[model samples]
Target: MNAGPSTAAGSAELRGEPPLVVDLDGTLCYSDTLWEALLLFLKHHFWQAWRLPLWLLLGKAGFKAALAGRIALDPGALPYDQTLQRELEHQRAQGRRLVLATGADQRWAERLAAHLGPFEQVLASAGGVNLTSRAKADALVRLYGAHGYDYIGNSRADLAVWQSSRHAYSVTRKPFRLADGRHTEHIGSVRPQPLAALWRAMRPRQWLKNLLVFVPMLAGHALNAGALAQSLLAFAAFSLCASSAYLLNDALDAHDDRRHPDKRRRPLAAGTLPLPLALAASPLLALGAFTLCALFDPLLLAVVGIYLAATLAYSLRLKRMLMIDIVTLALLYTVRILGGCAATLIAPSFWLLAFSFFVFLSLALLKRYSELFNLHSRGQDKSSGRGYTVADKAPISIMGINSAFLSVLIFMLYFNSQTVLTMYRHPYFLLGIVPLLVFWLGRLWTLAFSGQVNEDPVLYVSRDKVSLTVLALCFGLALAAT
Candidate 1:
């Protein structure tokens, strides 16, 4: 977030008239908590309900619009300690001016700014300016003159505004989970105890990813009749099944996660979620999911078995292999799509699967890249496979390359396919790749580079702007072709 004005060297007279410039992220709203909630939201609502290509078009602006309606983003999103509240109040009681400044976009800044009772104005980056430290420093200098008022912050980056301010204060308590790699927010206590914590632990984002099963059937309406019913059943079954896996994974990872800065706040690691309860909950959820599948389609039950096995393998073994772990994740997603096709007796084009894998792999690689950056900053070795360690940067980059190419290759092949030709009703629909390519290559990689990329590909796309535009254009073209 933008630091307040720097202090002048000589005297109080030299220090420009300082309005209170408050940082948005740590000072006002806790980023860690919001992100966790956002992750949950993406999994449950956006991911499953929105088509990937269309979701890609929603971008951050759209997502922020979504958040305004769905979340209580005002001052309530920022649950702060009593001590901080008094400190802010003390500052407010003073004649000092108040302005909310942050590295986050104007939307978030405004959302947060509206709730800060005393702030005079909110200054934030529009497209990209407000997201990094240097920019924040520049903003502080531009907005608040030399030697301004005392500044309050939480992270090392705040050291910039901290050092420059006449006086500074830092908060030690953080309200985010340890496993959460977002370092902008400090690790803090979870408000709710074991029960609420367990509910949160069941990740809804994977449920959105599970919607992959529906894509093929939607793409091919001939399989729509009976397959639609079966697909809906699979979706329900997998949602419960994935929740079970999340509970089990959190329990197993509690030991390791406790060591993590963010994961430590997780229910099990924090001692809020009891181990026995989680142990009981895991298999029971799984069994319930499986039972539902059994009543619907044996083939679906088998697919869920594979999903369970793969996830178990991931929890038990695969997560340690770095590149292999990512590959496994991609395959698992592909299998979900393939499994649906099998259950419905519909054949997915080989080219389609190829394209899907590559596209997802690209996003998976971006997640790894972000992980590597975070791990390296923490002075951890990247060689460990569970989370991308900094050591294997080459493979991650190479995997991204392959994944991008695969997306192009798949689309190109799809262009030649008779199914696409028949459905599209126009040879020109093949040109849809122009926007798709630009959207994918530009938008996703930018997020990865910016360290804003989400672990789930669908999540990342849903929050990107340019990608969404291209996606919309492509869809409009497809409609025209049809």
Candidate 2:
């Protein structure tokens, strides 16, 4: 029973008359994905996933609707379900009005209604301002005023009203021939994950950070015997530690991860690898990493502890914080340098500590800027943490400039260092800074503006042919300086 537009394009035809009430969750949103997550949450943390449908049919849409309300936006809803336009139009032409009636928040439900476009009346979950279940019925009856409706809804939550409606029409893409004679129309195909999703999330780009392990080992070049062997061990151990951290982060971010498009497909998020097995394997993997460190100085254990704590805190609550979170990462990077020192017994020079802190923090800020710009440009900035709005220029302009300056100072400081200054006969690392900056800050800002740098700049830079060449030049110059 279609009526007037919800409040947008075709809604004006309602003439304050009886309109259709279509629910949001199953009818408009690809709610099954959300349902699956809730199902999994219930299974892993509460009960089993298979019993969700049974619970839904048991007049439990109110509870289910509340749960679904937690995650308001789906990652793939750039263009939500639009196939109902024709039928809605047909019904509107037949002198019926259209409205949205749901057990979801009126505020959030408004967005779904807007996407459907041009509805006259909207009846939604009034849990906040009004009652949701029976009150929803009261609102609907008041709006239609005995004219009644061909109400479209998914669950038994609609049972009370379905009996009151003139005709019951169920929207389900999955074929169903009702015993009462009406058939569920085939809407279209349900979308599946594309192959590219896996590649994006693995973020092969950020793997560049793993190379930092080699930095300590490379610094070990100052040591004479057994240095290479020790360095290789450190690299292996560090890689394992990083991988372990990644696994742990993904596990903690299960819900938020599912809300992210690229992140949603992570093996753990997609339900490809069950959490129990992953959780069981994590400590074993971490223990193996610790074993690698134990092969070196036992002091390396402290380094591993700090790494674990910092990353765990980041995954837990630190990530939600804004600039402080960025600085926390800056300090965490210092911890890595300290860890390297612990592993190799190399006392970190004051300059190295200061420079690394600034440079790494600069990189972290750029990473934030990149993510911020991407979200803003792509109209996905609701996930922002820096308290910046999509339209606000302060985060980008102020933070971006600050990070670039810090990085440039780091560049200058490295050149000004006696070690680098004395080693480079040609004074080339200074010149190399030009392209390095272009590649470092320039390419990153470019990718960010284009919304292509959601991952890490280092990883993306490594893949860029020009950036790779510049990095090679920097490395060669640094080696030459050595």
| lDDT of all predictions | 0.63, 0.58
List TM-scores for all candidates, in order. Answer: 0.57, 0.57
Report the number of the highest-lDDT candidate.
1
Q: Write the per-residue lDDT of candidate 1 for residues 112-220, one digit (tens) a residue.
A: 6666566777766564243435566556766665446555565666666655554554444442222223222232222345578678777665577788888777666
**Residue ranges of candidate 2 with Cα displaced over 4 Å:** 1-206, 217-225, 384-388, 391-393, 419-431
- What's the CA RMSD of model 2 in angstroms? 10.2
lDDT of 1 at 323: 74
lDDT digits (tens) for residues 313-395 of candidate 2: 77656777757777887787677667667666766766667766766776677677666665666677566324445554456
How well does candidate 1 match the true structure, expressed as C-alpha RMSD?
Answer: 19.0
Point out where model 1 deviates above 4 Å.
1-193, 223-225, 383-388, 455-457, 465-476
